[model samples]
Target: MKYEFIKSHEYLFPIEKMCKVLKVGCSSYFKWKSRPISKQLLLKEKIKQEIISIYFASKQRYGSPRITFELNVLGYKISRITVAKYMKEFGLRSKLSKKFKVTTNSKHSYLVVENVLDRNFEAKEPSKVWVSDITYIHTKEGFLYLTTIIDLYDRKIIGWSLNNGMSTKETSIAAWKMAVRNRKFDKGLIFHSDRGVQYANRKFAKMVESYGVIRSMSRKGNCWDNAVAESFFKSLKTELIYGNKLIKKEKMELVYVFKRKWTFS
Candidate 1:
């Protein structure tokens, strides 16, 4: 206690004077200060810092296994078990997104194509054409719906929403609002999507039309009409959602993470 007090107030008062007042030997305090930190402790601290660095660098997306692999790649002699221990010590964890029990619920036989993009995926410029789609993600808790609006020119997700339901308000309208907020568009900008109920209903169409946006829907039987959105979801499944399960995460955080990745990728 005496040594601790002296160290705590060393900057504010002379160390020797504090030691003298506390009836402790100055030499004892000096000896403690001069002792070298153990090599193991030093190495432990270095590993801890590295763990923290990699955790946040991935937006908490990497778990112990990945972090351990990264450390080994960087020449750190560590094991996955040890990494997990330190992760627990620091209260670090990766967010999860799991479960695939269902598919999108857009099974109305509406063979409507207001303006057939006709597989013309190319966009002359940004905001001139935007494509939208929804895909399911499996979670231990339940299924999740990820709706995205991508500017075809850049193939970037300009707007997105993560939801537990496929309602128009939760899916298409929410995503379109975000897309408009994220990018400027003029009248007659073509907004293309599958003929899902969320995008087919009057509510969603009215929302898009209010902004002077043109609507385009995929044909009755062809999946290639909105290939841009389909391709994005396919890649997402193979790359991020195939084998490993993402621990369940908050819906909002998932949407934000998706937006950040596609916005800059």
Candidate 2:
């Protein structure tokens, strides 16, 4: 209870000092500390381990609130504050959100397609409606550009390509190849995307003609016109990109690793 003892073993001695200050004995304090760790402690450790595993496994996308909720679902009794402390100790952190600017250059004279989608995301058949979009990923090397085409009906990512240069060939070829691999050519099937140069280029237009598919583009400077593709990108950033906790050299490096991984769960 003396200041000398308080400074000797600061953390461990504090509890005993507190008990003594409250008129409790060292024998009772020892008894309490000596008692077997509760099942709750064991459970908390388990939850902590699982949380660390999930947090790192997800490349650091999860933070305390999400990790706490996950532990609760796994039958662990713990608070968010506890998870936050454990995360802090382990150097676990959530991903930093960066600003995303729209890179669509619709100022050119290229003809844009009509909005055939009309915000109808549903598809009766697999290849009936395909939505595509492009986004930029940051890296220490440089900006890495990405294009993805999705099957609206099955919610499957059918086609994707990554490149340093954002070109029409980069996107169209990726989408065309994916669509070709999946189903027979269906004339009048809609291929929707924003009115980026890649989608509106004459070469891309010709490629769409070669496939007998109709090209539909979002209106200029309109976010809602290509809502499906926009929403897909948003979810991708939210769940996979922005939510990650890892501080890698570049976003593309992590993205490349993630793309190759298959999450069965």
**Candidate 1 lDDT, tens digit per residue, 1-265?**
7876888798899998898899989999999878888999798899899999998876676789889989999899999999999999899988654544444445865344575576788987888998888888776687788898988888888888888887889889898888888899899898888777888777777777798887888776567888888878865664455554563646776666565556632
Worst 10 residues of 2 by lDDT: 256-265
lDDT of the structure predicted as candidate 2: 0.73
Worst 10 residues of 1 by lDDT: 97-106
Off by over 4 Å in 2: 1-96, 243-258, 261-265
The top-ranked prediction according to lDDT is 1
What's the TM-score of each model vs. the native? 0.58, 0.61
User: Residue pairs in steric clash, candidate 2?
Assistant: 60-244, 60-245, 61-243, 61-244, 61-245, 168-198
lDDT tens digits, residue span 186-207, model 2: 7888889888888888888887
On TM-score, the leading prediction is: 2
